[model samples]
Target: MADSIAELIFIPAPGVGHIISTIEIAKLLVTRDHQLSITVLVINPPPTFGSGSAITTYIQSLANTTMDRISFIELPQDKTRQDSKAPMAAFTDFINSHCKHVRKIVADKMSQPDSGRVAGFVVDMFCTGMIDVANEFNVPTFVFFTSNAAFLGFKLYIQTLSDNKNQDVVELSNSDSTISVPSFVKPVPTKVFPTICQSQEGLEFVLGSARKLREAKAIIVNTFLELETHAIDSLSKESTIPMVYPVGPILNLEAGAGKASSDDDIIAWLDTQPPSSVVFLCFGSMGSFDEDQVKEIANGLERSGHRFLWSLRRPPSDQTSRAPSDYEDPETVLPEGFLERTAGIGKVTGWVPQVAVLAHVAVGGFVSHCGWNSLLESLWFGVPSAAWPIYAEQQINAFEMVVELGLAVEIKLDYKKDFFNPKADKVTAEEIESGVRRLMEDNKVRTEVKEMREKSRAAVLEGGSSYASVGRLILDVKRNIL
Candidate 1:
């Protein structure tokens, strides 16, 4: 088995971010060990979510890349109707339904003489249900945790909450009381707990999934040790926890570095700006704002008197609509003459090459939704953030950035988007102006990020923490030594 090629099958949740990040890890393992081969099993989301165009495109880009050890296969859509469950539960149930297909694929891989030794399975945290399929094969499993270590510890800590303790969490969310997690340095406001896990069933689902992590041989987290020293330390100290490997920030740096894409017009504009002069405002792919909210942002940016690049998309008609479309005429949404007023100083575009933009010399600060991926990307480029988090676990991420990490200026840590009424808890222009100014003026944060950028780059090198962790992971998978 050691003489034959070792194959690693990666099962990522159907989200684009999850898929791409998982591929980055596969690319790393293959590059480090010439004996490794990777097969990424792609499962498209159920039909209710609009077009799967982005997901398809991202995978195609990988297939077209120069890497030969990595391969991608799209699984047949499950199409199993799980509407009887809650939204989050339904989505997870959808992932669970694909286990039979996963089992078949692994069986087929093992049967082929030239397919190499089945190293083990690498499943996304949300797809822990697939652990059963791995146990059936008597094979080891690893989880590619896409979030930060603090969030991971928070989940594990909450798993201790059962019966009366669980109800107290519900009450904490309903009220404004704060709670303590061993992972975080200070008390965490209950409002910032993951919005999905607020309900009793949601908490059970999150805890239930995270609890399965212990069954794995190890977990490959997309973070570096220096960034989350306390949380990572706590996780490592636990003897019962799965072997935790911090082998990141695993980004496709070459693809993002100095490479011009179809979004060259945006890049060309950045070329004209002075070094570290522009503030970038981008919500994630699902990010959009109401006209009133848009005007507020416009009012804020115009008042800040700073060069800026904003990626603004049209708000979806309702929450069920998965994709947000770009407006044909952005002027219709912005305040009249706002563009003309900031003509030389600002550019508003639909979609952006996020990493390429952050890599630009002229870009100074990021106004972001604080998605874990976005946070790591901005940090890699040595750019500070004015956090404007929306939905998901972004609120928790924002809190960590501002209060714990000191790498960001907070705009609104708890601004979740309202699909029905967009004006609900709208952040005012005053807040945006102050946050942008603070993001740029904070010498302390900027210096810390610049230092972190050097440390981040080093973490993946031969002797660095991330490099060591990856080596440990490879040995464990190759030898089943854990």
Candidate 2:
């Protein structure tokens, strides 16, 4: 008998982090025995430049055999006279408006001779409009949440807030102290909620899309139940959709499969270092700080007197958010004469194969932006971290790592935001010095984090709940949904 074919459609939000998660899902499906096919549909900002657009190039570079199973579809870009200045809302509107285009693409693909039999749809959680397309095709669609189930449950609570009743989120977040969300599965700090949701319009947008998200056939969160059982259970009970699969630490598994790094020179440098002596610092694709904060971080690392590896990036010319204007030189982000001073102890690079660097023996601690991907990567390698969340749901993710899970400590920066012009003030040298010392000098804290690392590793292994759950998701999709 001929093998049954399964067609999976992917529609990721236009961001490097989102694309990375969507691609990982597609790749995982392929690794299973299913005869899988993927269609990546893009709707906003043209997906033509930056790390967001670079995903296409990376996909093309995948093995030619893999290329045969995946397809790309592009829609007409909307250049309407809209307020593109506000990125989050503008981007959300673009995705919602692309529903018609998305539906059209799915229809055309289904009609093609080589399209094979449609089975199930795997849509990014953010692309809630694609649910209608799946319904039209009479197939089950699962929402692949790119973050932890805790975040999703928190989002669900925020979605239920009526615009008329709750004009802004300030009431919810007035206290920096932890606020108990009435229906949420876990206790979350109001500060971790998205700042944009503080406004009425932003609240409406989030609530509207969230309702659409709840319409999926099933939900797949990229985190293990062992890591978030209570949150996952709460979400499953509340949602009408029954299936909630917690299959994660996915990056760790992928990284493990990667060949050992061939950077002999770098490895040699690390080998000479003492145990638990180096701090590894990396921000995700979108994480960037102003020049002042960058200098504070550099100075802090320098004063800590520890071996370090810091990955840095230069801001683009047209950038407004998260880009620093003062640092014109490529190396200006670093402290003055600091590179020479820490020559024997510090390594600065624009970017490195992050997973590989984290896996190195010499690396002991991580100072990170708390992006879910980076968080998982750090935990997988048994490295404790200093959490520094910059944007999006990072603060929320950081909360889980530090306060809830007891995996990492939060690094606070002192800055002021003017109502007229909101740019972060530079981080002071003292703030940097104290934060680094807390991580490197505290033995009791490091030991506790080491225990958490062991738990994280066990959560992803065979017979572990996460591994078993992923197997069930694949099998269920193939047998029932497909």
Candidate 3:
């Protein structure tokens, strides 16, 4: 019989960012070798909010080439109604309980005569339930963290959040400045620490996940070690095994494989503009802004004077809209007078071909929401950023990218008093102008940030850290599993 075809399964928590990253990983697994017949298993979440269903459609369309090699399974939705309070915990519980279903699916797949034996599994760190499924199959399971290495390291070591040594919340949040992590990371502000990584529940999840890391045969991060060598080194030293591999800036590499959907218009448009004259802005689907913040952003961009591309979506009901009337509303929306006033200088659209835009020579900097996908895209394109993180663990990511790595700068929001809330504070046109100007034109600032762009590009090239790690991961799978 022909050598058993290697079957690899991957499960990402439902989101475009996670789904897209997983798809790239799957593609790489096959492109690296012809012998592997890969199967990608996705767990579909409810369609009400942005879910994997949309991504499922997108991936299925790409399956014309893979045919029977790639397969998918949808999870049961949690329709049982409950109060919206503690939504985070509720959602986490729902996912945790879904492992039995995942296991059943795997068992059935293994029973087939022509079925490929499991070569390995790629489990999203958040979907720890997949660990049980991996254990049942007795395959080498690799945890795939779809975040920057610094962020992943912090998440893996989140137990530090429970320090009763400091009762002050302010002190705890800012501990990075005072507390030392030894030889690796330079101290940063606690104010930028992710709230999730700062809380008891969040800490428990992260630290517990670290323990699970000990059981896994490998841990793969979608980051290049050169970009986050200190944090990756720190994590490697602390872990039970040093099997951590940084095979990322993964999306760009996938793009290079010629598997990405073609969007030539993005390139055509960029050719018309002068070099480093455009600012591309977008937030992942999970991003949310109140009415006040939405309007503030619009006014800010309008005043920034740079040629711009803004991807605007319907802001949550609480957010204000000062969107101009000329732009479409609700869907395919843009503000009124948005395109006219900045006719030669701006293009406002609801969704954009982000990778293509960033790759354009005209694009100089980014005004980003700090989504990991966007972060990776920026690094890939060697672009600096104006970071405005909203919700989730983005604050932590922003700090690492900006304060720690110096690849981006923060757009600080000001309030009248000592007590401040992002929901209440407004970012005016003036603040926007200042931040944008600094990112695009400040000589000293621009020079330093430009160096980061060069470093980012070098990190993913042929002999680069990410390239070597991906090679090592593939070889390890071949030797240990196949």
**What TM-score does prediction 3 earn?**
0.82
Is 1 or 2 the stronger prediction by TM-score?
1
lDDT score, residue 252, model 1? 62
TM-score of 1: 0.94
Q: Tens digits of per-residue lDDT for model 1 on 114-187?
A: 67777789999889998999898888899999999988888887776654265455555557778888779988
Best by TM-score: 1
Residues 1-482 of candidate 2: C-alpha lDDT, one tens digit per residue: 14767777777765556666777767766765556667767544433233333344444433233345676666566666345545546666667678878778778877898666667677777777778778888888888889888778767777655443553464664446555653344567666676555555556567876787778777888887766767777776774544788888667344323323534555677788887788988877645566677788888888788789876765544533333222235376677798789889987765456777778888888888788888888877777888777666677787777777777776752122222125655656776667667767767667776666676667657778777887887777766433
Candidate 2 local lDDT, residue 442: 68
Deviation (Å) of 236 in candidate 3: 2.1
Comparing 2 and 3 by lDDT, which wins?
Answer: 2
Query: How does each model score on TM-score?
Result: 0.94, 0.85, 0.82
Q: Compute the lDDT of residue 468 as modeled in candidate 2.
A: 81
**Model 3, stretches more than 4 Å misplaced?**
47-69, 75-85, 160-171, 174-178, 182-184, 197-211, 239-242, 252-271, 316-327, 330-340, 413-424, 443-462
Q: Supply candidate 3's per-residue lDDT for 141.
A: 86
